[model samples]
Target: MLRTVAVPLLDPTASFELGVLCEVFGIDRTEQGVPAFDYRVCGEHPGRPVRTTSGYAVVADHGFDVLADADLIALPASTNHADHPPQLLEALRAAFDRGAWVMSVCSGAFVLGAAGLLDGRRCTTHWRLTDELAAAYPQAVVEPDVLYVEDGRVLTSAGTAAGIDAALHLVRRELGSGVAATIARRMVVPPQRDGGQRQYVETPVPRCDADTLQPVLAWAVERLHEDLGVERLAREAVLSQRTFARRFRAETGTTPHSWVTGQRVLLARRLLEDTDLSVDEVARRSGLGTAAMLRHHFAAVVGTTPVGYRRTFRQTA
Candidate 1:
């Protein structure tokens, strides 16, 4: 259903983030069976160069007229400032009001906020700027620890490469997984990433050894059906319990419990996709201990229940 793709640029825009939108939709890749979009790079001033944040200039061939008819309107990163063009905000509000998919990359969420489109919507921006965005737009529900958040037709993504995740998610939701996978295969990127933006957020932790954990992690992965408590894992690694917990959290950017539970969820996802396993049996096989535990973890981490996931993604292979 997505046909026309329009990028609305602002002053002091980031080249790389804008480039991401162009790369995803600007090309003609029908030879690979991926549908091509009628892509337009537009700005308030047509045929004139706009200043970039990096002391560079980019010329957009189209003007604001392109956005009026777009199936998807994207806002790439710009200066994290509140001074957005008034007409740009109007265009954005109009796009959203009529049911077009509107997405923002990184600091671009500010632009959406300026447009009043993000008010009372669950949205996200770059983790670094989420607090600023929330403070500025108190009405918006800003999720600081998510890679992206979609409330209705509005999609907001985290910093840098996470735009690929948000865009591909839309493609998957609208066009099906096969098309999304085909596009990802051509792009040489993963079709999706697990976990939350918290995994990449800057935070302090005690220094820890990294070299020795590979074998331990591999061993634990193999025996996920068995108990993987910190005490048991520490005994297996021949370390004190407290030391093991700190080191594991430092290395994995998550607690031992969270990491092990995430691993079980992944294993359960594979079983759901590849085998005809019942919920209880899959939970038992994946070391989740029970179907209730599996359901809780699966829904929290993967955004779907076990049977729902299987029904959506079960493959013939």
Candidate 2:
């Protein structure tokens, strides 16, 4: 059981993002058989009416002192990008020094960076502010394209909706994929997405033009059992291999080969959790061809063998 303390700085965006953390982590969901987290919203000063950027105020009952015993500390997105409160930074440093997992959503990374927690660590924030973050903290490696970045004890997310992804990932890491998926299903979200994905996916400006690669992607998804090479996909799209490769990368921010591999791994994970399929059958069905091939790429991309991932995440029907 993890005790989470959310330190919401005074601002509209940060307060709302803190509310999201409360909804995801603080609420009791044991009826769904999901483990409940002990969560509380605290402020730098207790019982004070903290103003939000959106012309709202929230009163928090606890102060920075609540952070000492927390298993996790969350800093939500803030409106003020220039500086964070000094006392809050001190409390965050103390919590991290005590070995608590510290996380931030969007510009909340600023708070973590202020505490010197992000130094020498790979982290991310909103793309619009990536340059500022990089300029402000020369010691941190800022990855602008990623949705989130987890560096040991500290985790930082890109922006708004990506905050949910970061929070769910933390649940997946602490609990298991099964529990995380349950929560995500209840929340009507895809259970897992690679943290290195783009924060804002560029959609075609017009809906009609949005059919860019839908047909090809759908065709590829349907044929997960077959080896999907770039030539085959290009043929399906009626384009040359070079054009298809460039278009695919532009559309997905990943190569066709890498995208296919990632999709296969995802399919394999879904099978591991939801079915009683043998590893060999799963490998064949997910397009990796054989169990040995599946094990190799699964370990390379997922950091676990097929059997091990199944053992860790499988849920009995």
Candidate RMSDs in Å, in order, are 8.6, 9.0
The C-alpha stretches of model 1 lying farther than 4 A from their native spots are 206-317
TM-score of predicted structure 2: 0.62
Question: TM-score of every model?
Answer: 0.66, 0.62
Q: Write the per-residue lDDT of candidate 2 for residues 48-77, one digit (tens) a residue.
A: 788876678888888777777888888888
Compute the lDDT of residue 228 as modeled in candidate 1: 93
Candidate 2 stretches with Cα past 4 Å from truth are 12-15, 194-317
Model 2 is weakest, by summed lDDT over 10 consecutive residues, at 199-208
Q: Would you list the clashing residue pairs of candidate 1?
A: none
Whole-model Cα lDDT per candidate?
Answer: 0.86, 0.80
Question: What would the per-residue lDDT of candidate 1 be over residues 1-317, giving only the tens digit for each residue?
Answer: 89999998888889889988887788788998888889999988988889888788999999888889899999999875688878888888999889899999999999999899989999998888989999999999999777788999999999978998998899899888988898788788889976566545433322335776766787888999998999999888888999988888778788888878878888888899899989999999999979999999987877667877777579897
Best TM-score among the predictions, by candidate number = 1
